[model samples]
Each structure stands twice: as C-alpha cells, then as structure tokens.
Target: MMKKSFATLTSVLLGSVVVLSACGSGDSSTGTPAPGGTPSGGASGEKVTVTLAGWTSSADEKELLQQTLNEFEKKNPNIKVNYEVIADQYMDVMKTRLIGGNGPDVFYLDAFEAPGLIQTGVVEPLDGYVTADFDTADFEQPLLAAFQTGGKTYGFPKDFSTLAMFYNKKDFKEAGITNPPKTWEELQDAAKKLTKSENGKVVRYGFGAAPEIARQMYMMKAFGGQVSDDKGSATFASPEALKGLQLVTDMHNVEKTSGEPKEVGAGWTGEMFGQGKASIVFEGNWAIPFLQTNYKDLEYGTAELPTVNGKKGTMAFPVAYVMNKDSKQKDASWKLLSYLTGKEGMKTWTSKGFALPTRKSVAAELGYDKDPLRAAIVAGASYATPWVDKATLPTIMNNFNNQFIEAYSGKAKLEDAMKKAQDTANKEISAAK
Candidate 1:
C-alpha cells in the first residue's frame, strides 16, 4: 500500500462514540485528561483521553498493549489511552482521517510510508522532546536514521524485521544435505541437488521467489547494488543493481531450481516453505510466530541469508511510532511513545515473537543476543538498508516491480528489464517532483 496520511473523518466518528460511551458510563477511570491539564484521577479535574490507532489486531498484541497502557496509567494516573484498531488497508483509512483533521494522536508508521507522510507535513518531529537520556544511541543506526529529515528525527522505532533464510529441515534431510549453505556457491549447489522431480513433474522446488519490491530490495543489496543514488534518485540501471536483478532471474531461468509464485500457484514464499513445496526461502522474522502457530508440525530452521559473492547483507524494514503534527497532547504523546518503544515495553512486545526490537539494549535484555534466529536478524541490522527512497519511491517501486517480473519469468533479459525500470522510475520520480 502507498503510504499517505489518513483522513481523520472515520477517527472523528469513532472518537465520538468512544467519548459518548465514556460519558454515559460515568466511569472517570476510562479516560485521562489531555496533557498539561489537571490530573484526572481525582474528583476535581476532568478526564483526558488519547486515541491510538494501528494495523495490528492480534489478540496477544492487543492484550500486551493494554497491559502496558494499564501500567502507564498507574504511573501517571492522569493519562488514559483509548486504543483503536485500523482494519486492513490502513493507509487508505488513515489518509482519510488525517486529511479530515481527526486522525489519531499516535499511530504506527512503516519506513516505506514514513517518507511520504513526512513529505505531507502531517507527522510531528520528536527531536525537541528527545533528551540525551532517551538513549537515541541505543537504537540500530539504520533504523534510527530512517525517521530523520533535514538532520532532525521525527519518530521512534518500535520494532524491526530483517530477512533470513528459512529452510525446511525435512526437505534438506531427504536431499542428503547435512547442513545449510554458508555461501552463494554452496547455496546454488544445494538448490540444484534438492530439487525433486517425479515422472517429468517437479515434486518440490529448491527455492521460491516472490517478486515483490521488498524482496528485491534485499536481493539488490546482496550484490552491493544501490537501488537509489545518494541523492535518492533511481539508479537500478547501474551495473551493480543489474547484477542483483540478474541473480534472481538466473535462479529461475538459468538454474531452473527456483520457481516463481505464479508457477507454484502459491501466494508467497512463506506459504510455499510451510507447505514443504520449497526447500529454502527468504522471509522476515514475523514468519516465526506464523509457522509456530499454523504449521505446528513443520520442521524448519532459520539462518542468515546466504552471502552474495561472499558478502553478507539484508534489508531492514522498521516501523516507528509517529505522532500527528497537530496533536494537542504533545507531551502526553511523547511519554507514551517513549514508554511503548522503551526497553520495558519493547521486551513485552517482542517477546510475543512476531518481530524483532530495534533497540539494542532491549534485544540483549530479551536474550535475543544469544537466540540464533534473533541473532541472525540482529546481526543483519548493521548492513541492512532502508526500504524507502526519497518521497517519490513508492510510485517508482510500483512501476519497477511490474516490469521486473517479466525478467524473473524469463520473458526479458535482466539488463533490459532493469534499464527499462530505471528509465521508467526516473520519469515517475521527475514527474512526481
């Protein structure tokens, strides 16, 4: 989804209902007063209420957030958090509310979308509120750097995700592979051996490629390719970038070991790996909980994404908590932001295993420092590249991916596809600007 500020109309509707309900219940405990206002826990002051909206609706995440908020209330006694769940297609819904001036005070912002929202001047900068003690240094540099504009930081990273190689243990054993591949050559060899065929039909593929922008970003980085120039202009036409695209296309066209999503009729690599149709796949840490809960019997293990030409690299997709620029409760929002993204809250949220914390201290505190899966993700952070470019990247990426698929399917050469994408992306970026 393209990142844009949400229209606040729906939020206004939702907020009205919440306010009316809070009033009718006559429970002062349900709401807190706005920042700089009188304490709401006593009879003399009015209650203040702040709304939080995000795309996550997992029962566990909601409960954990509620528990955290309850603790926040207990400490402050003057603040109450009214959490709202934004359904799927959150960007559309959020854009409406933001444009309508009724958006939530605080919301989750993906790095991909953050640049666009910041461009619209909808997000508030947090540098003024941040103190030296907030330990901005504790965050992974790349993650913390994503939310900055003109040398000023605007958001606090809540969680991060990085790609890793998830291999099917059973498939490897059947293929006579005793260990996972450690280098690109080993990976290619294993993939060739693991591919199974029966009666002229492939029973299981060695790998699966989902031709999405994010996956390609990691692949591009693997070959030391720069997706965007230093000035944030499209540069996929460069030799390094084409080399990355060539690697992905070769897996399908040249090696014949990897199949595209369309060929397998599988929606994504994660699903293909879970079904045992693919021996190895690259996916985010979020897949951990999904496999644990849904594919309970699947024997799988994760390793660092294999090096490209002997160099290890991956992409980091981090989402941060960004406050509305027009929010009236700035101080209150900052407090909640710090607490939610702080070491304590990060530990609680990441412990659920859906994501990796962006905070180095939190990861260490949660024992991810030693956990193999978590360590792979954490280790990639240093070399990880952001998933966005300057403001016009979303449009550029969309056009690039649509054409890049042709190369992945062997319909076109990698150089031709990438050159076309580069030209098209440059035009789009120029037009948008």
Candidate 2:
C-alpha cells in the first residue's frame, strides 16, 4: 500500500501510535553525557529514556514493536524506551511538535514524507551514527536511498512493501484462464475473457483499478514518462506518461472490463477482489492479512505485476526510524533507532509478515522469498521504485488524484485532465516556493 498523506490518516485502517514531549537530559548535538554522568555514545551507564513514536495498523503490530523495544532495553540496559501512540493526524502533529522543539527523540517517517521533513533541517543525519557493525549495505538499496539526499542519510527504513497482482483462483478457473497474465497485452486479453455481465450491468469486472497517482506512478514509468522532473515540476501529463495511463482508462471506459472499488460499492481493491466483484487487483502485502482475516474463504495467488512495455515495475512504500535533530538524548535515541532497524530487531519486527524487512539479510533469513504468497513481493524489491520525490509531492499528488479521477470516471480526457492537474500543481509548487 502507498503511504498516505497526513491529512488522510485513519485510525481504523492505518492503525494507531503515540508521541511524547522530550524528557531526560544529555547533549543535544553529540549525545555526550551531562556533567557527572557516564560518557555518551555508548549506552552502558546513566539510564536515559528515548521516546519512540509511530503508527501501527493493529494491536499485533504495536506489540511486535514493543517486543523489539524490550529486546533493545535488555541489550542496552542503560536506555529505556517510552512508546507513544499518535491516534490521528500523525504528520500534522509531528510537524507541529518538531517546530515547537518538543518532538519525540525517535519517530517513524514514511519515505514519501521524508524529503519534505528532511529539508526542514530538524531531522538528524544518521551517517555519522552508523557504525561498521550496523552493516548499512545490508539494507535494500532503493529503500535506503529514499532517506538519503545529497549523500547524507536522514533515516533508516524499517520495512517496505511492493505492489503485486492478486488473482482469485476460482475466478481464473471459472473463466477458463490457466495462469496470471505476464504482460499488459495478455492482461487485456485475460480481462475480456474474465469479465462477467448480467444484462450488461457488469456483475463482475476482470480488473480493479486505482486512479490515484500513488498507484499509477509505475504506469507512468512503463512508457518512459515520469511523474516529476529533476526540479520537482509536474511532467506526468506528457504523451509518454499518458500512453501507459491510457491503458487503464481504456480498460475501464472503452473495454468496460475493469472498474474501481467505488463502481462495485467496495472500499478498496482488496475488498473488491475479495467480494468477487473483480477477479484481479494490484495490491501490497497489507491486503494479505486483510483477506486472511475477513475473507478467509477466498482463494487467491500472488504474482509480480505484469510488465509494461517489456519492463517490470511496481511501487515501494518504505517507512523509517528517524531522530529529531534537537533531541536532548541523542545518544540514547540513536541506540533505539539503530537497534530497531538492525538485523535482530528487524527480523523480529517482520517475522509475522505485517510488513517486509528493509534489510536484505533479514528478508533472506525470514525466507519471505520462498513463502508461497510473498515470493513475488520479495522478487519485486530488486526493481521497485521508491514512492518518494521532492517536498512538493503531496501537493502534486492531491491535484493529480483529483483530476485523474475525472478521467477515470469518463468525465474528462486523460490528457486534458492531466494537463490541468500538472498546471495547477506546478502553480502551487511555484507559489509555495
């Protein structure tokens, strides 16, 4: 699943977490111990509490994180972790607290929001804190790169997920389809055969589509088009981008073989596929647990998304643990941050598969690549695009999604709608600058 904007944070679907004011004492700049306290950087003596804040999608995820923290505490007996849950408006609250200088020592940062927050200079650069023992190279390059800017590291991604095709086995059998499509052309052929209609009312669609920019960015890339240029200006409206996007629009409008969740009165593609309204959907690992819990009887298989223009592509959403530049307990905060993203902690955090580990070692140790349902997802890490860009992405995303929906609904042409979106977004970015 894509990392959503702070404005759209939901307690039910996105999970819950907490934040806290700074507590305890130490040097804010270097993590050196205060006078009469043990030396800093090493967490051997002089107990210090580092506050960690993040949102968990469920109680299990929260507990899993707590277990990791508990292990860190045992290893570094001098440090105590204060876990806080932010119920809603996570980014809004985080930004407010950051500006006020009372933000948590360590917190969760989505890659999509990392660029914007890092540019503010309040995020501590972890390059210095990273040690040889940390094995920085062990992390998947693309995931780690999301938090890097100008060769400086701001955060370490804790976990990530890539989009994969989820197809209902029963639907495939009923449609006389033997396998999932491996290319866009084959996908169209499959869609035509799988579509079921009752008096032209479309009782079932062959594909479920998401019109949001987050989901369509890879589609844009398939044809050598990009969402934004090096300057962070909108470029998705270009002809190359539209060539790939048109496939989706055509599938829904002209071919009439695909539909979004709203068309079937569902909340998301996962639900649309689970309810048998759509035989196939492109979703992330988040949907796996959802179906297992809510649609237990649904028989589905996962596969790497079909290649577009002969190239495989998918969106990767990664979240990291970052330190506040102003934290008084910088040393203790680093301990917590490093431990959580380290091999031992990451293995535990991702053991249950709520999310995929960001570290290559952890993923191989967990054997997710061999797990029947997770293999395709793990295979995508090699080429997945990190869902991130310049700070103006939120604004660009809002405008694009608004207009893209108009095109998806057949109310406007994709080119016209995208041009309007790009113009409006660039104007907003320019005005903000």
Candidate 3:
C-alpha cells in the first residue's frame, strides 16, 4: 500500500513533465538555486523530484542502477528520482549542460575530472548536507578522500575498482612457469618465455598495456617523478618521471614483447587475453565478469601488480555521486545521494559483484575480502593511488598520450617525446588561463 501511494504521488507531481520512460531525459527546471543549495520543501505537502544523469553503460549495468534507484524511492516516499543515461562523450555533454544550466540535479563524477569540475563552481559541496546517520567514516579513507579539499566534501565515492595482474594459467603452464611474477625483473623474464612466434611472425604478445596516463600514472612515481606540481601545472618531464615511464615503454619498443588493444585487434586487454592473444594484462574486477561472460572456458588467475622498484603500487579508479550547484531540489538531491552511497544502498548495488563497495563495513559484510577473484583488488585499496590529480589532468594527459604513443612505438626518443609532450601541455595550460 505504501509503495503504491509513493508511485501515485510521483506520477501526480511529474504529470506535466512527461516521464515516458523510467530513466529518460526531460526538459524541466525549477529556477536558479542559491550557491549553498536550496532547501527541500516549497509547499506544505508537495513531492519533490530529483533529476540524475550518468554515462550509458551495459544493459545489465544500467538495470542494476535502476534497481538501486527504485530502492531509494521505496525508502523515501516523498522524493522521486528522474534518471537519464548520456550517450557517447559523456563528460563533454555533461559539462555543456552544466554550463547552460540544463544539467540534472545530480550526476556521476569521475575522480580524474573532479578537481577541474569542482573549480568551475558548478558542483555543490556535500559537507553541509551530510547527516549523522550517513556514517561517512565507514567508507574507505583513500577512496572517500579523493573528492575532498580544504576540509570540504564535494562528492562521495559510490564504488571503486583497483588494478590487478591477470595472467592466463594455460600460458603459464605451457611456459613451465609455476607462479606469476612478483617483481619487475621476474615479470620481464617471464614475458620472454611466454612470448610465442611462428615463422618469424609474433603470434602472441607476452603482455598487453594500455599506455595511457590513467594506467601509467604510478609509473611516474615509481622512479621519483611527479606528474604535476601542487598548482596543477604539467611537470611530468622530470628525469625521474621519464625514467619510470621508459622502463615500461621499453618493453614495447626495445624488446617488442608488449602491445596495446589496437595492435592485436582487441577492444581492450581483457579481450586480448580472453582471445588468447596475450598471456598477461593488468585489469580490474570489471574484467572478471567480462571474461566470464565471453570466454567461460578460459582459465586465469589474479595477483597483486608486480612490485615496481621494490615497492608495491597500483592505481585505483573510483567514481563519486555529486550534486549540481544550480538544482533547486538540493535538499532532496542530498537525500538521494546519501541513500545511494550510504551503507544499505551500496550493499544492494554491489551485491552482484559488478562493482566493489566503497564502504569498509559493506565490503566486510559482502566478504569480497575472502573471494579469490576479488581479494587482490580489495587488498589494493590500502595503498592504491586514486585515479585523480590537479585540475589540469585532462589537458595534460591528452598531450602526453599523443606523443607518448609515438615514443612507445619507437618513432620518437623517450626523452624527446617527454620534452615535447611537457612543452605542449604547459603551453596549452597557459593559453587556457
């Protein structure tokens, strides 16, 4: 009876807005809201609708988000959610909408882009809306801390996935290797043995690499290099950063033992390994389900990323839910945000293991720490560097990847490429300012 009433109430309130589908876009506005955020109630007994937008994902993933949102509506009868999936170039579209004041009340923010977007003054700081029951401390400190600055909480991580070494058991057995690599030296040696060639034509690469900044940020620090200074300017050309990066790119150019997705006609490393094109790839928990669904017969094992420079390090990618600064329903949106990232909703969202819960309590309750496939990924949370940086990361990475590819392909010297990428990145950053 209560659920039915809630449904009817949402219908009546949104009748004029035309909700043709559960998670479809609609043109609706409630006037410009104040900076701190608007309070919930406008009328004595009126229902408030909160609009949300996120990037389009797989059918199953989309359905899971829907289920999570439905649960929120059930718990908070007075608040109704209007969700939509933005198509390709999600961040580009989202930024344009926010600038035009047509953005949703709440949306997903990748940690990589959080610093820049928060600087734009369009995202609401979440510190003021938090309630005592939200139990903010339960979330993994590193993951939760990514969205914070100057004692202000602007977003809360909904889930996180960390890098892990995914190796093919068949390839290892055939190569007479009983264990995955534990150190960089061991990994390079193992790669030589695992690599196969027929008639002087390489048949399988020993390792698959993404060669992007997101995947290689840790490499910069591995050799005492820094991607940027505190002010967010590009500083990745330092000798230490290049030294660390050259170590991995050398595997591709110097030894010809590594390649990325395009070189093998695979969409990603997961596909490259699943199709038996590569023996090892660094992937996250997301790859587990992909491999399971597409290549059920393939046997594989997971391990912590090979120690670099005698130090254990890996990258963690986490996304958070942030509220729009211009939304009139800020109070209502906070309710949904808190509920979605809160303990109960996270358990339901992560129950199927599509994503690992960000909350320590929820992760313990789910027992992913004991699951073989997920244990390595969970263990990385303690040390993994969040996939985030100063505001210029997007621009800096674009220029770096453009030239770094040439260097990785042996078309340019590693040091030359680093200098070129850094100069161009710094110039672009200056031009923008």
lDDT of the structure predicted as candidate 1 = 0.73
Local lDDT at 125 for model 3: 92
Q: What is the C-alpha RMSD of each candidate to the true structure, in Å?
A: 5.7, 2.9, 7.5
Best candidate according to lDDT: 2
Per-candidate Cα lDDT values, in order, are 0.73, 0.84, 0.80
Tens digits of per-residue lDDT for model 3, 143-180: 98889987899999998888889999999999999999
TM-score of each: 0.87, 0.94, 0.89
Positional deviation of residue 156's Cα in model 3 after best superposition, in angstroms: 0.3
**What's each prediction's clash count?**
17, 5, 0
Candidate 1, 1-433: lDDT as tens digits: 1110112212321222212111111233323453434222323444456667775535666677777778777876666777776655667767767776777778888787888889788787888777777888899999988899888787988887777788998989988999889887788899998888889877678987766566777667666677787666787767877777787788788888988655766656677777777899877776676677769999988888888876777777888998877565656677778888888777777776666789998888888867866677777877777776677677667777878888888888878887888888888777766
Better of 1 and 2 by lDDT: 2
lDDT computed for candidate 3: 0.80
Tell how far residue 419 is off in model 3, in angstroms.
0.7
Worst-scoring 10-residue span by lDDT in model 3:
1-10
- Screening candidate 2 with a backbone cut-off below 3 angstroms (N, C-alpha, C), the clashing residue pairs are 17-85, 17-86, 18-84, 18-85, 18-86
- In candidate 3, how many Å is residue 49 off? 0.8
